[model samples]
Target chain A: GESVGLHLPTLSVQEGDNSIINCAYSNSASDYFIWYKQESGKGPQFIIDIRSNMDKRQGQRVTVLLNKTVKHLSLQIAATQPGDSAVYFCAERGAGAQKLVFGQGTRLTINP
Target chain B: NAGVTQTPKFRILKIGQSMTLQCAQDMNHNYMYWYRQDPGMGLKLIYYSVGAGITDKGEVPNGYNVSRSTTEDFPLRLELAAPSQTSVYFCASSRGQPISYEQYFGPGTRLTVT
Candidate 1:
């Protein structure tokens, strides 16, 4: 079975600081990976995604890094804002449109 | 498009009771899914459908059931609700098929079972 996991349980960073959340997946067959931001009392929102062929991908203020060799993925937010505070999750899809295995999640808090 | 929409923003169930979580999408997506979120555990796939008349169990399908009667709707049913079934539920939809599909989520439904 494919599983996604996060390295940190919680992280607090001062406003305007960069925040990096790490994720590790066990499924090497997974070709697509996504990062989602889930706030309190809300569903997870798509943040960004990376393909196995690509080593990195970037979105609005976010970046997703994929290291196929280590089966690791990460999300980096530049100049993190208060709105960036949420539970960050990493999800992996193994070649079908069926379901995505989600990570345990990392709570990101931006301190002002 | 309104994307994916789920009914009953919140629900409370008693032991041995049953309830259904409704899910609908206007994007004409063929793929739909149900997931449950628990504290620190993230989201676990409960059930999913590829198209109308097609449905399958996911990682944690026990105590839950799902049906896709139309292309736009996929509803999850809880036969006998239990305390362990208490959690936030989310409905998501994707375009589906042989390509890499990105999922859009609904607001969510918070269900509490006692």
Candidate 2:
């Protein structure tokens, strides 16, 4: 995932609402993508991931959708709660390479 | 397991001072990575190692050096500190390579260069 500068820095969502955060990547060579969540002053934690061949993948309460045609990636948090509040980042990895390219990051604030 | 751990949560360095950031992983991961995160910016890869004794540079590797002498340790070196080098540094490791595997990260080390 890529950010020209800093576009979506913050996102506010109600406790029970489903939140959608968007990300765009510049490198088309990226074949695998993943989402990460980082709490204040903490390290980024893996959320979900999807391969280029597939368009969508889901996990516990999160879903990741990849649009290779548009070079877009998005993460959907179902029933966002205060516990889910954190900075969400999208990452991309090239085929057969372990290094990942990270997105700027969007701070997801779950309002109670 | 402590997953991944980094030493010196914070540090302040002078323009020409040099220091090393230490990273250790307990999962015995074959792949390890070092990244720097600037305020309001994405994490930029500095260097990575697939296994012990192998190392390579990533997107923004300028002025940064790394050594992976052990399977569990990856250290980042800065010879001459610069204001531009101030940022939060992270170390991560994973059992999978190239394709995919959940990467576990350390708390991070915040650095300040005056």
Clashing pairs in 1: none
Best by lDDT: 1
**Tens-place lDDT digits, model 2, residues A1-112:** 4332225889999899999999888778878888899998999998888989999999998999888888888899899888999998888876666777777899898888
Alpha-carbon error at B40 in model 1, in Å?
2.5
Return the TM-score for each candidate structure: 0.97, 0.92
Mind giving the per-residue lDDT tens digits that candidate 1 earns over A58-102? 888899999999999999999999999999999998875467888
Question: What's the fnat for candidate 2, on a 0 to 1 scale?
Answer: 0.91
Q: What is the TM-score of chain A alone in each candidate?
A: 0.96, 0.91
User: Interface RMSD of candidate 1?
Assistant: 1.1
Error of 2 at B49 (Å): 0.8
Two-chain DockQ for model 2: 0.83
Write one digit per residue (lDDT tens) for candidate 2, span B8-109.
899999999999999999988998999999987778889989899999988889989999999999999998999999999999998876434678899999
